[model samples]
Target chain A: MQNTSLSQANPTSEDTSKPRKARGPKWWIDFLVDLAGIYLFVVRFFKDLFRPPYEFKEVLNQCYIIGYKTLPLIAFTAYIGGIVFTRQSRPSLESFGAVSWLPSLVGVGIIRSLGPLIAGLIGAGKIASNIGAELGSMKVTEQIDAMEVSGTNPFTFLVITRVLACSLMLPILVIFTDILALLGGFTNVYFGEGVSFSLYFSQAFSTIEMEDIFASTLKSVLFGFSIGIIGCYKGFTSKKGTVGVGKAANSSVVMSMFMVFVIDLFTLQIMTFIRNILYS
Target chain B: MADTKSNFIKPLFDYEGRSRVVEIEGLNKSFGDNHVLKNISMELYEGENLVVLGRSGTGKSVLIKCIVGLLTPDSGKLEVFGQQIPGMKSYQMDAIRKKIGFSFQLSALYDSMTVRQNIEFPLKRNVHGLTQAEINQRVEEALDNVGLLYAIDLMPVELSGGMKKRVGIARTLILNPEIMLYDEPTSGLDPITAGEINELILQVQEQYHTSAIIITHDITCARMTGNRINFMYEGEFVLKGTFEELSHIDDYRIKPFFEYNEF
Candidate 1:
């Protein structure tokens, strides 16, 4: 390792710039490559999913790690977010003489959109970055290659478990988030809006039909799955070096954030369409 | 002496030369303008320890990766267990991969997993339809073999460098792979620890009777564990011989490597 540094008397300016900027191609080409990589990952994952010695135990272990372990962080974030959002939104609503509608409005809005969206973003920060770094380090150490030589499918074992865990557990987390956010709104009504606890819940729940809750919950599930899958994918496919690992971790967060936005827009559109068809 | 008798008495090295575990012929790989492996051809027989010695960037690790189907060569005929590798389907490569084990130089135990969990990972995931008890037994046996039975529950971070390498060995052995590939097993270890690791490699090689191809520039380690050592330079296998024979070679290109103790 020391010899590697001795041979290069000095790094040229171009060498430093290469890491920060992707030269030799237009920006559009780089974007297309990134898009293509995402597409290929999705296609390959589905392709290799069912064929072979199944890694059920690994998937279960991942669920325990990714899903079960992340519970406290998700719950704490959601609880605080709910309380703070409601508390902050209360004065504005009161000035408009809309204090009575606090529970229904905050409850529906938080559960339907903000709760899952913010939760997914937090998951990106917490779970996605972790997955990237962990798998990135594994790549750098050649553990993934070791797995391959040992006649084990590194992808099937490592990638599948993590992706599946995130896909399955993220929905459960979002459900918890939804409940916590509503409780926070309920608390705000009791303390700030001068409404009784039972009255706030009953009124809040009355306005929120099953469709509203379900639509938002569904989006969160997809959001969670996307975050987990993209994070693990980037990390697992990282190049075999220290720099590669850092790049993988950085890309995982960037791609996950982009996916969250894209998925949110599409989900919102579908939700609105459903509402229009049902009510109209 | 009893030492000679004990060494001779150990029938672990005996192999009838039944099958080839790894075969590389006319292999060629290049990274951009720099060629890494050129016309490389070698065969790894069952129960043989083949050590590859090379300087940095000599395609040693790349050669191992190609055998495992991790990286595809530019042009090559590579075969493992009678299956052609260059054109084999991904699923096919996966099937062949199940019969191999790898111990990385960096002791690539998953940081998030406990030592036991790391060892159990390959078996728990790859070997289908095994009962939970069976998996546990395998994990225990693997850890015991590497003398890491006590540290099973500890995370990778808590273990020393030596302990981490042992856990990596146990993980590789969980599947009882027929072939094991080691990449610079002693590169980053202290002399004493490195010796211990070499002993562990010998033990695993003996007990499992698995064919091993180790990539390292450490001459001491190669001498201790290698039955046949191949000297690689500039993407070529410049010399191949038993360690005893290679150490005595008078060739100008190879003699300096030994004379300077540069491996």
Candidate 2:
């Protein structure tokens, strides 16, 4: 054993060499690779969801964190948004002698588009960054690796639970945002025009169709998925060190928001196309 | 390279009358033109501590990671308990992983969990059908083994460096693994703390009768824990012997490590 061959072993003589820079591929190539990685992540998540020992406890914990913890901030922002929009629209409607339309207009806008979009963006910023940073730190510290070597599936415990929580919770949070925003709108309309609460709500409900509610709820679901998946992907693939954690958190927020807009655009187009087919 | 197929037929413990738990042959790992491990080969037998001593970046940690199937080698034959690691699927690797415990350099305790929770994590996951009482009993036993029973309820953030390492070892020992892979187990501790860790490692090995691969630069740790020492330089094993045998070696690459007087 002492005569173990060293013919192929070339000893490193000096330690003066600079650490190699991690040269990334071109932007387009990087984008394609990231897209592929996210696609695979989604595929793996679906594959693992049906497997045994579902992480129900972790899922509930995440829902508490992602949904319950986010209510105050989401509600506060949505309420302010509703008041600001109503105030901005009041003068224009009053000039056009369409003040009576205030309840219907704001109600339709809040229920159909503004509510889900704003709530989705808020969830993306709050929940996405939270998940990213938490998991990035775990990766950096080898907690994730420890979990794996201990025969626990980190993907099932960490990624699937978080993604499901965000996807399920975001829609519920958006409903809450829509209701709060309408209340805020009602308050503004009452002060501005002395509209009775009964009359204002009647007008509000009269203009919001089943299709509008359905479309917005569906959009929120997609937004939630994008936010959860993007956040998990960024974190799971984080490189070594604290800088990697920061990057993961930053990019999770940015990418989730970007995907929100992209999903919004596609959902609107698809809704319009379906409506056209039905009417035609 | 010399008829390793015959090794498969040989009884699991028949490598010179000692059972081989981990076998590596012609292992090569490279990171984008920078060769980290070059045709490395070694064997870890049962009931013995195998220490690999090397500089910080000489692939010691990488070798252990590969053994645990965390890092896929470029090309090599890595068999942990007769299972080919590089080609094994996730579930297969997971099955093998259950029998092996890896204690990371930083202890890698979960910051969100208390010491008790961290130790119970593996037990709850791997050993099914255990009641909570049984789990708690095992957690206590593991912590007691590492002399950290008093720190059970404390979170990882509250523990000092040596305390964290003890907790980490306790967490790994909870599974009662057959093979242990330790990555720089005493790299950042003070001298006294480092000596304590080394003694704890020795006690654990003797008590559990498990084979281990400890990668470290600490001479005291190497001397205290290793039954055989492999001196790695530039991703290759430059020498292999006992501490006393290697101290007298004339090779300059292997001389600096033994020259240090500090314990």
Candidate 3:
């Protein structure tokens, strides 16, 4: 007989459950359970984020896929949206005799609200569904299980990299969206009012505050986190078979879009409260 | 660079001159109200192919999943190499997992990666200080073992079912796993392909001298590859013995299995 040897592995994925109580209605019970699962999943992401054997290579790859690949879609939509919104808003501003205020108005609107919302919605749609379907397919087909058996943590390799990529890439995408949308506004302003390039940009930057950019970036980051987490949670826990994968993909898009608006509402309230307390 | 770090898992030898690598006692698993595994007890000795024969939904997959730390058994003792592994986290099982290779029912090769990348994955992630050439050599060796070196660069979608299974085996084999857990290795294949897979399982055993737990309902696969057999039905073992001993048994639940698959 020959002597057998052993190799090393470090998967670092998640926990399992034993017999537990189920209270309340089935849907309510499932809701609480899912809530708890998402909480743990997010907590584990932070824990695994700092753990050793960091997968920077995979993170970079995900950034390229999530950020670079989605650029074209964001640019086109943001530009078109800028033109349409600016054209509509100009009539109201002109009626109020604020035609000269168009550049500053568009700048504040896009930076403080429009740019982030567009980027958030677009990111949620593209990145969330893709992650959801990809991870869901892996779950059902047992590729994730295969990774666990191989000593590589699928969560770190799959979830953390994706979530981090979304978080890091969204703000950059927003910056691009902000620029392109402002340019779209510029096209409309130049055609409609014959405004010069330098004068229009000067008016745009005059009302822009650093705090506004910071607030928008913060919102973008949160939106990115929601996009990553919801998609991952759905995909990671997806069940049944191909149907489950499809459901995961579909729900990721819907949930992510809803989350972006919900987050927007809450953040709007909090920022308002802070501003009132500071100024009043 | 060379790896100086080593991990050793010494198997426990019983008085009968056989070592039990995996020892399960009173194992039970359930989902919601459905009791999938109930009061199951079994043993797998060193270098032996132990087949857990069963029909669909007999909790065979859950049983092996528990052993591999994919699913936590609701209750019971599951020991691998004398270490208890019930409800343990993934990191806790990593050392033990390196020695256990599980082949899924549907060959779960990483869909995005090529066959070469798939085989190279484990080594690249876990094993340290190996040059690219060394990794490539091990990958080629593993694929060659499964007779799939020709399809190394191809993606999984391009391969046939049997070829995918072969690649999955090659991926696991590349890890140098001491204990192999095959989840219906011959399922979803034609008779000829299934026969080839069974032959491959035997060849892996003969070459690697690895202990394996083959979960299958196919009696021919059991007869061909299992050193001992345990029949699973309704979440419990109904019958167990060597192929010759099980073939002679006169039980109703066991009769149809052999008559249906073996005849």
- The top-ranked prediction according to DockQ is 2
DockQ of 3: 0.25
Cα error, residue A166 of model 3, in Å, equals: 0.4
Docking class of 2: acceptable
DockQ score of each predicted structure, in the order shown = 0.20, 0.35, 0.25
* Model 1 lDDT per residue over A1-280, tens place: 0000001011121111112343488878967887787678778778888977677877898888877788888778887888888888878888999877778777777767878877788777777888898888888876777666665677777777777788787778787877787777777667765788778778767777788777777777777778777787788778858888888888888888888889989988998898899889
Specify the highest-TM-score model's number.
2
Q: How accurate is candidate 1 locally (lDDT)?
A: 0.77
Candidate 3: tens digits of C-alpha lDDT, residues A112-172? 8999999999998999999999999999999998998999999989999999999999999
lDDT of 3 at A125: 93
TM-score of each: 0.84, 0.93, 0.90
After superposition, the stretches of candidate 1 with alpha carbons farther than 4 Å from their true spots are A1-28, A51-57, A87-96, B1-20, B125-138
Query: Model 3 reaches what TM-score against the true structure?
Result: 0.90
Of 1 and 3, the candidate ahead on lDDT is 3
Which pairs of residues clash in candidate 3, taking residues 3 or more apart in a chain or in different chains? none
Model 3 has fnat of 0.37
With a 3 Å backbone cut-off (N, CA, C), the pairs that clash in candidate 2 are B13-B19
Q: Local error of candidate 2 at B56, Å?
A: 0.3
Can you write out model 1's per-residue Cα lDDT over B20-78, one digit (the tens) per residue?
78888889887665677877878788788988987777789889888888889999789
- Displacement of the residue B187 alpha carbon in candidate 1, Å: 1.2
